[model samples]
Target: MRAPHTATTLGSAAPARDGPAQQVARFGRHVAEMCAVMCVTLILTGLAVTAAAAALGTSNPITGAPAATAAVATLALAASMTAWMRYRAMDWRPTLEMAGSTIAAGAVMLTGYAAGVVPADALVGGTCGLACVAMVAVMLFRFRLYASHAHHAPSGH
Candidate 1:
């Protein structure tokens, strides 16, 4: 005699994996952790800048602006690296992109400083702007990679 049909045999069993809600919650948690890292990095960077300014006798508003700008840019780059590590998990491409961008920005800034194309006071702002642009580009590239992967992943996934 044929075996009696069961839910499993009928292909109606529930999935063993977490549902979409759980997946979203986990993603949210990861984002929160990354944000926490960014916050800490920013705070530490600010403290370091403040200390350095005090030590250099440049704590006055006029001189401090450039230092502050440089510090903010460096901290932003650090935060981007942190996010890349958390999300991409040691992927070299993004790291290389970041490094290349930073170096290029520095070179440009130095060249401008030497040529007097950019005033000393404006160097920090230019560097910060370049770094920010580079970071945004990297972020866009990462998003594209993720989108393509998601699109190509097997339906079962």
Candidate 2:
């Protein structure tokens, strides 16, 4: 007679290992953490700008703009980081596209600052933008490093 099955079956088994699903869940958690950190960073930056503006006088339009711009930039930066993390975990092509776009935008922004079009109080906003661009660059480099290491592994497994 056939023996009864004692081990877990297909539907009853746990995940084979931390595969794509675990990677995705990890990415989601990372995104949430990044967002929270960005929120605090932006808020502090805005408050600093506002205080500096008040000291410099409300007549300064640049000071006021930075507070608002910083908030938006921070949120965008968080989103970009999340995308980069996800891409790093699975793919590189789309990440390249995003990194290219981000770098181009960052260049344009830095140009504006170099032209003296940006106000002194809004310098913080420019700094935040640059940081976001840098984050993308770091992510790209990290993926490249890991990919090379993975390819050279002795066995596919």
User: For this target, which candidate reaches the highest TM-score against the unseen true structure?
Assistant: 1
Instruction: State how far residue 68 of model 2 sits from its true place (Å).
Output: 14
> Which pairs clash (backbone N, Cα, C closer than 3 Å) in model 2?
none
Task: Output the number of the lDDT-best candidate.
Answer: 1
C-alpha RMSD of candidate 2: 11.7
**Model 2 misses residue 149 by how many Å?**
18
Q: Please write out the lDDT profile of model 1 over residues 96-146, one tens digit for every residue.
A: 565566556756775776687977677765775675566556655665333
Q: Over 4 Å off in model 2, which ranges?
A: 1-16, 59-108, 113-157
Q: Which ten residues in a row have the lowest lDDT in candidate 1?
A: 148-157
Expressed as tens digits, the lDDT of each residue in 9-81 for candidate 2 is: 4887653344466545554554354445555656765566556667877644355564345444544554555
By summed lDDT, the worst window of 10 consecutive residues in model 2 runs over: 148-157
